[model samples]
Target: THSGTSLGGGDDLGAYFGLGTATGVDRLEVRWPSGLVQVLEAVAVDQRLTVVESGLLAELRPLTWPIEIGSAGGSFAYRLGVTNLTEASVEVDVWLHIEGPKGVSITRGPIRRQLGAGSSLGLTGSQNVPGGAPSGAYTMTLKVGTFPIAEQTASFSFSKRRGTGRAEGGGCRPGLGRKL
Candidate 1:
């Protein structure tokens, strides 16, 4: 049986089975949403185990390391690879999360795509840094399906840029701002 929740409510995302005094499961079968069926033998009982979809791979590749952010803010780009190694085509949903300093977080789409059998798809995109984001370390997490497949961390630092200053009064005067 599957779990369901009402609107504005939450529920546990786990499946429970009553073994009825059975010692362990001899076989376990899972039918995934992608039309892929997986079978496990000799499964243990009374323990939590993560089941990752077979023949699907997700990878995160950052174009730059230790991203630098200026006072005016900046943007970072990355490449994501999703491969289907099975004999049949499957549909996948990709999600991204970037967690920054001071509990700042950014979430990106469940970008849905269909991949042919034994083929790979590349997704490239950039994310803008909020102007008020603090300079510190950040982590980007990639999730394929319900599993987090990859994670990468980078540092963000503020760089000083020159700006023109205005005169105290309305007079025509030009001055340079303070250098960092």
Candidate 2:
């Protein structure tokens, strides 16, 4: 009613709304000062919709991940892929929690990054496994922007087959990856 203590012009005197974590909106109704009503339906998220003689409606989309599994060690890197669908850009913070054999657990940082609007990002980082670490299963969980994204589990077993001329694993050649 323009009776509030707002410093803006008459354009800011209308109604405002906010929706959190909602996927879609079925219908939105608006009433003008001239006693005319307008309704909009089937609106999608992460978009800016304009209405004639009415205010603007906006929606935000959440982040998504494509490749969820990866191998982490000195010879290979842990990869992450994220997709942003919102109209504006966003920053993604990465964190890691690793559970190794013999009840060992490690926590990594809150790395921050800026993501473009409606774009995807792929990043890779290395992880260190101690030489004395037992040969067993290892788990790595990833968190994007402080939210848990995905978890990858792999078995770690090392052996020396260079002298015998027999490879241990498939699709991987020895001395091909980054050395420690």
Candidate 3:
């Protein structure tokens, strides 16, 4: 059995079942805490399997304007839409990460929210880009769920305006974004 402690301690949550002289099992059933059930047939033995829940969908939509950065800094805003495809309300965690040129990475949140069945929620926010950041392509990634049930990415670029000493660029280019 898998167990844990509530007193700020750690426990191994892994479950191991030994099948003597058996090469495989006929079926496996997993009942999630959220009341979702999954079944696997003809399962192979002696290997670790990672199962991810698939009751949510996420999409990332960046503003269609160029990101303008002045001497001090600038901010870019985006909208993330999440949909619950299940029949019941489910709680999930959302995370946003901005990765820029030269290994500059910024994390926005692990915001937790609950979505009703067949309902959608839009999360809007902005992220600050520091002054003098490298001029190049950047990527914004959105991840949803406690175990990453869905993910999407959007791309943008930053370049110095000719003779203006400022940086400006656009994301959400046509056919540039993709889901993962």
Candidate 4:
């Protein structure tokens, strides 16, 4: 919405002596995408677009992936924190997809689940932490899906300390991203 007014020379500011002044008006015109043009009698103005909610990106946070390995076998677990951007309740499918390190094959864990509106889903699913897994960087995917509503993703890296067997924090990037 815009409102503008023009100042006539009648309200002269520095007009004295011969007392002659000038007033100027701006002409506005817009061309629509449909090849239609619209002209209006107006002056200079300002315009912009602001996103008020639904369009805003939701907040997605994932805890570092925890992995354990021993004689009893190995296990993995991770959690997701969801912050609904919309005022109303929304459903989100948050899950983990872990790829086993070279020479190690994981057969279980990592599944899909939903999140409640304006809330988050904390998942602690147990999975086999690959044995003799190379103690280097690991690639993991933490995804949140809300069909017909919203989709969010968190891609991150975590390191495993061989002797201590603890995972370090390397938070993922924010935003619902491109495919895969």
Candidate 5:
């Protein structure tokens, strides 16, 4: 069948297998030059299959984000959790964007840390509100790896000094609305 019309097994042309019928190839058999016989079942026609000796692949996944917000003394505190899903360890950077009254915005630093695969890291931080600060609502955005994961808004106002306690009239108190 090598009358120059053969489809394969020639010099630098590689080996090729052809199915003559239109009923779709149900099975394929391969006999390697190393005297190893392999059979594949339920294979369709005109489809390609890659055979690898040692199976190895690369996997990429996004990190998981969970956040919690609460009051820490005179400051607003928050706990952020980051879960890594990659095969290798990854370094994560955390950023905070705070939007307050009168179009005030505060951008926090790029807190960098290493996170192992399938492990989670918890970070606790507080945003201090200075004494006699304005009474208004604030929005805190948590950004992980250049993406906004979660946002929390809380209102603050100055309460009247009722008793001789740490929470004086000068300190800011949590207002009525708080959304997690």
Candidate 6:
């Protein structure tokens, strides 16, 4: 995270909220080069996995994907913006996972069927990147999973034309172009 523009890493990796009071709270032990020592504890306790705490003033900054794939009254066109200064409201379960190209999958569930409270829901949805999903860089996990109590994890990953006639750069090139 050193050269990632900003975010120093703590407040348990939300990096700090409202941006203050996280001074030198370190926990280091990721050694390698042949010394070997990392049984676990980067950050994940895993009890069926749940970590609910997010009045987190801000962190998911992605604006204007602006619905780039729309047809047939529009099904899901990928317009995920984010901002919730927190009063109370967040039910984000956007999980559409499809992997192929030696990593297989034809479906994965839950893409914002419903969510409301405290606002900020530009999370449009879509799936079926499966033209035999095996070309390259195919790992889409919009898996917010009610994440951090839904205060964050307005997840990301775009480019859903999944090329075969080979048109992988921007948009509109896979056949059947259905309802968004």
Best by lDDT: 3
- lDDT for residue 34 in candidate 4, whole number 0-100: 40
C-alpha-based local distance difference test score of model 5? 0.44
What's every prediction's RMSD, in angstroms?
15.7, 16.1, 13.3, 18.1, 20.1, 16.2
Which pairs clash in model 5?
Answer: none
86-152 per-residue lDDT for model 6 (tens digits): 5666545543344435646544444443334455544343333433434443334333435322233
- Indicate whether candidate 3 or candidate 5 has the larger lDDT: 3
Model 6 spans with C-alpha error above 4 angstroms: 1-52, 56-77, 81-85, 88-117, 121-134, 140-151, 154-164, 168-180
* TM-score for each of the candidates: 0.53, 0.39, 0.53, 0.38, 0.40, 0.23
What tens digits encode model 1's per-residue C-alpha lDDT throughout 1-180? 245643334464466677888889976777777765555546788887677667776666656665555545566666676677789988776676666667877666656668899999776666565445665666665556532432111223322222332211122111111110
- Between candidates 2 and 6, the one scoring higher on lDDT is 2
- lDDT for 23 (candidate 6): 42
Clash count (model 6, backbone only): 3
Q: In candidate 6, residue 36 scores what lDDT? A: 30
What lDDT does the true structure give each of the candidates? 0.57, 0.44, 0.60, 0.39, 0.44, 0.35
**Which sequence of candidate numbers ranks them by TM-score, best first?**
3, 1, 5, 2, 4, 6
Which ranking of candidates, highest lDDT first? 3, 1, 2, 5, 4, 6
Residues 31-77, candidate 2, lDDT per residue (tens digit)?
66754344454567767665554211111111222212222222234
Evaluate residue 33 in candidate 6 and report its C-alpha lDDT on the 0 to 100 scale: 39
State the number of backbone clashes in model 4.
1
lDDT per residue for candidate 4 within 110-134, as digits (tens), equals: 2344434555544333334443556
What's the lDDT for candidate 3? 0.60
Give lDDT for model 6: 0.35
Give Cα distance to truth, residue 1, candidate 3, Å.
35
Candidate 3 lDDT for residue 9? 47
Where does model 4 exceed 4 Å of error?
Answer: 1-73, 100-117, 132-136, 146-150, 159-180
